[model samples]
Target: MSLYMLPLAIGPWQIALIVIIVLLLFGGKKIPELMRGLGSGIKEFKDASKEEEIEKNDKKE
Candidate 1:
C-alpha cells in the first residue's frame, strides 16, 4: 500500500489541546529539554543524509 500525500488533519484547536496535554504531562520545565533533544536529532539526521548523498555522488563520479 502507498502512503497518501495529504496534510495531517489536525486543526488549531486540536493542536492547542495536544499542547495542553503535553504541558500537563511533562510540565513546563521539561519541554525545553525535550525540544532541544528533538532539534539535535533532526540536525543529525540531516547531516547523515547529506553525507550519504555525497558518498553516492562520489561513487558515481
Candidate 2:
C-alpha cells in the first residue's frame, strides 16, 4: 500500500485517453514508423545480448 513504491494501475479509460493523446501528438502516419523503429531497436538489443552471453560462455570454457 505504498504510494511512492508502486506504479499506478491504469484502467481501460486511462489507456484509451493515452492512445488518443498519442494520436493527436504524433498523428496517424508517424505512429507506424515509430513502432517500426522501436521494433528494430529492440531486435538489435536482443541480438547484442545473445552475442554477449555466447561470448561469456565461451570465455568461461
Candidate 3:
C-alpha cells in the first residue's frame, strides 16, 4: 500500500518545460510584469511577517 501510494516527483526537465510554457503563453513583454508582481507579493509577505513579530515582542514586554 505504501509503495503504491508514493508521490510522483518533479524533476528539473519538468520545471524547465513549465517555465517555457509560461513564457509562450504570456509572451516576452509580459514576463517582466509578472515577475515584478511576484516580487512585490513576496515583499508584502515579508513585511507582514515582520509586523507580526514586532507585535509579539511588544506583548511580551
Q: Clashes in model 3: which pairs? A: none
lDDT tens digits by residue: candidate 1, 1-61? 2355335666898999999999999999999999999999999999999999999999999
Candidate 2 deviant stretches above 4 angstroms: 1-6
Q: TM-score for all predictions?
A: 0.85, 0.88, 0.78
lDDT of 3 by residue, 1-61 (tens): 3666645666788889989999889999999999999999999999999999999999999
Identify the leading candidate in terms of lDDT: 2
Q: Between candidates 2 and 3, which one is better according to lDDT?
A: 2
- Compose the digit string of candidate 2's lDDT tens values, residues 1-61: 6897556877898999999999999999999999999999999999999999999999999
Q: Which of candidates 2 and 3 is the stronger one according to TM-score?
A: 2
Model 2 lDDT, residue 48, Cα:
100
Candidate achieving the largest TM-score: 2
* Candidate 1 residue pairs in clash (backbone atoms < 3 Å): none
Candidates' lDDT values, in order?
0.93, 0.95, 0.92
User: Candidate 3's C-alpha lDDT?
Assistant: 0.92
lDDT of 2 at 29: 100
Off by over 4 Å in 3: 1-8
TM-score of 2: 0.88
